[model samples]
Target: MLSAAAAADVRFYGGAPRRRRLRPRSCLASPPASGGGCSESESEKARSLLVERYQDGVSKRYTLDGNSKLQVHWERRESAVNTVEEEEDANSLIPQAVKDFVLPAGFPGSVSDDYLEYMLWQLPTNVTGWICHTLVTSTLLKAVGVGSFTGTSAAASAAAIRWVSKDGIGAFGRLFIGGRFGTLFDDDPKKWRMYADFIGSAGSIFELITPLYPGYFLPLASLGNLAKAIGRGFRDPSFRVIQNHFAKSGNLGEVAAKEEVWEVGAQLLGLSIGVLIMDTSGVKSSYSTLVLTWFSVRLLHLWFRYQSLSVLKFRTVNLKRARILVRSHVGHHVVPDYAACNKEENILTWERFLHPQISFGVPMEIMFDGEESNDMVDRLLKLYRNEKYILFVKPSGSRSAAFFVTFKEGATSMSVLRSLWQAHWLHKNLQRQDEVFTWVEESVLALEHGFTDFLKQMEIAGWDHNQIILKVPKEPVLVIEHPDQEV
Candidate 1:
C-alpha cells in the first residue's frame, strides 16, 4: 500500500511527479467509493456530478446505467425532429435545390398557419388551370390564322393590326373593370377570387368556340381576351390581399417572391404538359377534344379554388361575415367567432335573395332624392344626428327591403361595422311589420347601449377589429359638417 501523499500524487499527476497539490473532490468523478457507511448515496452522487459537470456553464447530457454509473454521449444541439417534419412536409416531393430557390427561407413559419393547407390545393389547381389556359391560347391562335402565312402581306398586316387592336381593347377593358370594382378585391377577396375564376372560365369558353366561327374571329377573340384581362386584373389584386393575410412574420416581400417562384414553376410545368398534348393531337385536332379538355380543366380549377379558399379563416369583418354575425347574435343572443362565421359563409353568394338587399356607400344624391329639401332626408338626418352614418330603408314589393348605409366623412371601420349591425337589426324588426319609427328608435337604442358589449365579445373571440372589410366608395364621400347638431 502507498502512503497518502504518494496516492494523491499518483491520482493528480498520473503516477508522475506532482506539480502542485489539488483537492481530489474537484475532479468530475468522486474518489472511488470506499467501502464505508459514509459512501455517497446514488441521488446525492447524481446531484454532485451534475453540479460539477455543469459548472462551466455548458450543459452536458448523461444517463445512469442500472448500477447508477453516470454514462454520457455528445450530440448536436439542433431543431427538434417534429419541427423539421413540419417544415419539410408540404415540400417533401420537391428537390432541395428547387425548394431553396422557390420557397421562402423558413417558409411555413414565415406564413400563416393555413399556408400549407392552401398551397396543397393551390398547386394542383394552378397546374391544371395553366394547362387549360395554354390549350385555349393555342386554339385561339389557330383561329386567328397563326402560322398560315410565312411572308408579310396586305392581309397579314390587316390581321396583325386587328390583333393589336384586340389587345388594346382588352387593355382598356382591364382598366375599366379594375377601376369599377377595385375596392371589392380588398373588401371581399374570397368572393372576388371566385368571380375572377368564373370569368376566366367564360373567357376560355369564348376562346374555345373561336374556330367554329372563324368569320367572327375578331369579335370573339377580342371579347375572350377582354374577359381574360379583366379576370387577371381582379385575380392579381385579390391574390395580393390573400398574400397579405398569409404573411404572419412581416415577410411580405419574401412571401411574394416565393409566390412568384411557385407560379413560374407551375406555368413551366403546365406549358410542358400543354406541349405534350399539342404533340399527341396535332393542330388539326377536332373541336370535340378541345372543348372537352377545356371544360373539364376549368371545372377542376374552380373546384380546387373553392376548396383552397374555404379553409382561410380571416378574422376581419366583411359584409357577409357581418350579416352572419348579426343574424346569429340576434337569433341566439350569442356571437360566433371568425372561424365559425367563415364556415357558415359562402364565397359564391352573389345575391342574397332570401335576405334583404343591403348596399354600402350609397351616393348622397341618391339618398336625398336629388333634392336638398326632402322631408324624409331631413327626418333621416335628424335620426342619425348623433351617429357617423345615415341609414335609409326602402320597402319593396316583397318581404325583403333595400337597406342602404351611407358613411359620413369621419366614419371609421368600427363605425361601418356598427352601422351594419344596426341596419340588420332594423331589417329584422321591420320584417315583423313593427312600426318603422318605433323599430328605428329601438335599433338606435340597442346600438348605443349594446355595441360596446358586442365589441368585447368580438375581441374575446379573436376578431381583428382593425381590418374592416366593408366596401365603401373612394369618391363622393358624404361629409356631415355639423355632426353634433340636429336637422
Candidate 2:
C-alpha cells in the first residue's frame, strides 16, 4: 500500500491525478496511514505517474486557452513588419539641423482684416504715384536743358507749370526768362561744363560781394534751394505746395493737372542734376549727336537719383515696416494658428502695438507616449537637453497632447499666463507675443494627432505593430525650474 503522506506529496509535486486513475477501483483497498512507509518501487511508480499527468494538464490548458495559437496567428498576420522596419531606417522626418535650430518663441498675432485691406488699397497707389512722379520730372528736366521742352509730351509736366505760374506760364519757364541773360545758351556745352564754369565764376563773385547775399553765393545756391524745397515739400506735413496752390486757384481740375505737372518737374530736375554730376564730366558735347545729350543726361541722372532716393526712403521709413511684416510672415510658418489672422488691415494697426513684444528663437520639445520605457525616456531627455530648448511632455492616456517647459528667453510661464488673462480680459491682441506658447501647444497636438492617424493607416495597410511607433495622447505637465538651473 502506498503511504498517505507519500501519495499526497507525489500528487502535490508531480501533478493532479488523471480522472481514470483517480477511480476507487484503481486505488488500494486499504491505504496506509500517515506514518506507514511505502516500498521504494511503489513510491517511484507513483512519482512517475504524477509527472506524466502534470505534462498532460499543461498541454490541455495551452490548447483550451488558445494562447499559443493566437500568438502564432498574430505573427502570421503581421507580415508587413519588415516593410515598416525598412521605412523607419531614418530616425525622424525633421532634419537634425532644423531641430537643432531653435524655433521662435511665440506666434506674431495676425494682422487685422481691416488693416490688411487698407494696406492693399493704399500701398500700391502711394508707391505708384511716387514712381510716376519721379519719371515725369526726370524727362522734363532733360527736355528743358536740351532746348527741347516742347518734345516732352508728359501731360503731368505741363500741368505742374500751369499750376505754379501766376499768369499760367510755369515757374521754371518764367524763371528761365528772368535769368536768360546770365544763363548760358541752349547750344552751349553740356550743362555739366556750364555748371563747372558757373561754380568757378560764382566763387569770384562771392569773394567780391560777400555782404550782398551774405553766405548764399556758392555754386549750390540755386540747386541746393531747389533740392531742399523738393525734399522738404514731399516729406514735410506743413509744406503743401500742390494742395495750397490748387486751393487758391479754386479749380479742382486745375489742381489735378498741376499735381501731375509738379511730379514730372521734380523728377526731371533731379535727373538733370544727377546727369550733370555723373555723366557730363568726362563726356564732351558735340553737334548733331544722335543721342539727345541733355535729354540723355537728364534721364540717366533722374533714373539714378530716383532709384537712390526711393531706396533710401524705403530703407529709412518702410524698411522697418517691411521687416516687421516679414517677421510676421516667417512667424506664421513657425506657428500656424495665427496665419489666417494676418490680414493687411489687421497688420496696419496691430503691428504698431504688438511688434515690440515679439522676439525670435524659442525652444520646443515633442514627446510621444509609446516611448515610455526608461531607456527611451532617458534618450528623449538627452535629446532635449542637448538642444537647450524647452521640453514639452505629453504622457500616455492624457487629454491634452502638449505642454511647454521652460525656454531661455521670451515668454516665461507667468508671462504666458498673463497674456492669456489679458487676451481673455482685454481686446484680443491677435499678434500678442504671449499667444506663442498657446499656439505651439495646439500645433504640437495637431501634429501628434496627425502622426497617430498616419501610423494607424500604415497598420491597416499591413504594417507590423513593432515596426512603427504609435502615438498615444498623454497628459502634458509643465516642469518648472529655478532660473539658476540650466534648461
Candidate 3:
C-alpha cells in the first residue's frame, strides 16, 4: 500500500481519482538491470517520470511563491506612494506668503501712509494747502451738521429716496432740514459775515464755504489734517459716542445735515456769483444761473468718480487686509484636505502676481522617512506592475544632487530605459558629460483660458507628432485640443 504522505501528495496534485489507486511497494518496484542496453532504457523511463513529477509539483510551487512576493512588494510600494501624496496635499494648503512673511516691516509705512503720500503728490503745493484747509473746514461743517440735525442721519436720508432705499428720509429731507424755518440765510454780504462768525476765529466767508467743495477734492485735503483729526477722534470716546448714535440711527441725520449744508452753500454761492456777474455785465441773470447749475452737475460727477477710485485703491493696498487675504489663500494650499482637495493650492502662490515685489520666499521642504533611492525604485516597480511608462534620470557629474524618475499609466520600463540611454549618449557625444546621469521627463504644458492657442504655439514650434507625457492626478495627463495637434 502507498504511504499516507504519498497518497496525500497525489490527492493534492491530481485530486481524488488518483488517490483511490495505490500500488504495493513490491508491485511498483523497478525491475533489476539485466544488461547494459536494457538497463539504460529502464533507467531513462524512471528519469522521465521523475522529471514530469518535478515540473507539475515543484515548478507550480515556485510560480505561486513568485506571485506572492510580487503582491507583497506592490502593497508596500503603494503605501509609500500614498504617504508622499498625502504630504504633498498637506504642503499645498499653507498660505506661506501672508501668514509667515512680514510685509512693510522695513518701510515703516502703512497703507494709509501711502495713500496720503500719493494724494499729496498729485496736487500742486498751493492747491494741496488749499485742500488741507478745505478738509479741516469740512470736518467742522460735518460736526455742525451733525449737531444741528438731531432727527435723522444723512446716510439714512439718502437711502430712503433710492428705488431700494436703506433708511427713513432721503437727500431732499437733508436739504429741507438744513433750511427748515428759513435757518439758511440769503447769500448777501451781511449773511456772509454772520456765517464767518459762526465758524469761530477762521473769520472768512471762504472758510464757511470750504466744506462745500466736491467730495473728491475734499478728501485730498481731508487726508492731511482733516483725516488725522477724524481718525484720532474716531478712536476717542467722544467721537465714538457720536458715531454710535449715527450708526444706530442708520446715519439719516448725518446725511441730511451734510446735504442741507451743501445745498445752502451751493445755492448761496451760485446766486451771489450769478447776481454779481449779471449786475457787472448788465445782462439778464438767467444765462449765468444756468452756467452755475451746469458747473455744479459736472463737479458732482467728477467728485463721485474720484471718491470711488480712491476707496477702491485704499482697500486694495490695506496691509492688514491684504495680509489676511494672503493667509486665507495660503492656508488653502497648506491644508488642501480642509479645502476639499481642490488643486487651488497649486496656484495659491499665484497671488503674488497681484502685487509684484511682494516676495514671500520659498516654501519649506517636507521631510520623508524612506531613502529617496529606495522610494524611487519602489515607485518604478509599482509602475511596471501597472503597465505604466517610466523615465529614469541619472546625472553624470559627481556634483549632481539627485536622480529623477517619473512614471505614467501607459508606459513601460524598457521604453523609459531607452530614453535614458539616449539622453546619456547625447551628452557623451557632445562632450557635455557634466550633464550626465541627470534624467528629466518633459513637463506638460498647462493651458489656462486659451488651450487652443497653446496647441497652435506647439505646432509652430515643430512639435508635430511628438508625444507629450503629463503628470496626474495633479493635472490632466493629456490635453489634445485636436487629434492632429500634439500636446
Candidate 4:
C-alpha cells in the first residue's frame, strides 16, 4: 500500500489554489494502530480478515418463527436459474465527470418549500437575467449620460424606470394570473407538459426578447429554451429524467465550456450588430447607441447562461450520493441483506421507466395487496367522496402489490391518511385475507431522503444486500436523517 501522504496528494488544475494547502485525506485499508507500518504477514492477515468480514456482512434476512419472532437461521428463495431481473434506481442529473463534484453541505435540506419563492426567484431564468441586466445597464447608461435622467436621480433605476424597464408590472400581473389559472388543472404529467410547452414558450418570447435584443437573437433563443426547461422541471417527472440522463453519462465540462463560449460569442455578435446599426443609420449618438444596446443584450445573455448552469449544478448534486449507494459485482449485485432478500439475477433494468409520475402536491401513500385495481380505486374514491388523488410512485420491485396515491393541496393530511388506512384495514379483514398494507404521508424530500437512506442501509450489510430491502414493509414508519450529519 502507498503511504497516506502519497495517496492524498493531487495536483491542482491551472494554478487553482496554488498556495493554499490541501487538507490531508486518506483511504487507509486498516485503522492506524502503531507508530510504524505493520509487518508483511500482519498486512496479509488484515486483508484476509477484511475479506471475511465483508463476506459476512452480506447477510440474508432473519427468518421469522410461527409467533413472528426472529429466528437465527437462513431461508433462501429458490434461485432464478431461468429468469433474470434488475434493481431499482433513483434519478441523477449529470454524467460521471461532474458527479465527482460535491453539493453544498445543506443543499436540498436548505431548499425552501415556499411555492411563491420558487415561482418568483427560481422558476423563470429569463426574468432573473432581465432583472440583473436592467440594473447593470441602467447604471451604465447613467454613467455615460445617455437618456432622460439628468442629475442626482440618474444612478438609481427608479429614475430610469421608463427608459430601461417599463415592463415589470405587466410581467408580474401575468405571473399572478397564470398562477391563479394553473389551479384549474389537475396533477397529470401529460396534461402538465402540454400546458408548459404552450405557456412557457409564449411567456419567454413575450417577456424576454426585445426587438434589438443582443447576440443576434441567439441569447434570446437560449433564454427562451431555459424558460421552457424551468417550466417543464416544475411539473413534469420526465423533465428530471432528461436531466438525470445528462448526469448519468453526459460530459458536464464540455457542456459548461460550450455554454460559456456561447454566451460570450453571442454577446460579441450583438455588439457587432449595434456598431453596424450606428454606422448605417448615421446616428449622432454612435458610442451611446452601441454601448447601451449591445452591452445590455450581452450582459443579460451571460446572466441567463449563468442561471442555466446553476440549475445544472443542482442536478449534478444527486451524483454524490450515488457514489456510496451503488456497488457492483461480477455477474451479481450487492446490498445490505442479500441472504434473505431477492437474489435473482436478470438482464432487465427496473430503473428506467417510461412513465414516471411526478407529484407536486402533498402525498398520502397506500400499499395494497392487489396487482391492478378498479374496485379498489372506486372504493377509495367513494370513501373520500371523489376528492382527487393522483397515482404517483407505483409499487414495483420486490413489493409489487402496492400503489402510491397522493392528495392534492387543501386536502387534510391526517384525514387522508386515516381514510386510506381505515378503508384498507376493513377491506383486508372483510376479504378474510392477511394482505400486507400501509398508509403514510410523504413529501418530495421525504421520499427521496427515504430512498437515500434505504440504499445506504442496504450498503451496510454488503454488496449482495438485495435480500435486505431498506423500506420496512410496515405502516406509520418514518426514517429521518440528521441535516448536516455525516453519513
Which has the greatest lDDT? 1
lDDT for each residue of candidate 2 in 73-153, tens digit (9 for 90 to 100): 000111265346335534557543332232211111433447546755887997788567665655665555632455655
lDDT of each: 0.63, 0.31, 0.29, 0.34
Off by over 4 Å in 1: 1-162, 281-285, 351-354, 361-382, 392-398, 430-434, 471-487
TM-score: the better of candidates 3 and 4: 4
Worst 10 residues of 1 by lDDT: 48-57
TM-score of each: 0.61, 0.18, 0.15, 0.25
* lDDT (tens digit, per residue) of candidate 4 on 375-425: 343233333333323332333344322334434323343223322323232
Enumerate clash totals for all models, in the order shown.
Answer: 0, 27, 38, 18
lDDT of 3 by residue, 230-345 (tens): 22222232223323334545885686577579769979997897677557543454654545554565467445533432222111111222233223322331211212211222
lDDT of 1 by residue, 28-127 (tens): 3222343222235543453211111111112222333334443322222233753575466555788654554445445668778887788789989977
Candidate 3 least-lDDT 10 residues: 359-368
Give the residue spans of candidate 3 off by over 4 A.
1-251, 282-487
**Model 3 residue 235 distance off true place after TM-score fit, in angstroms:** 29
**8 Cα displacement, candidate 3 (Å):** 73
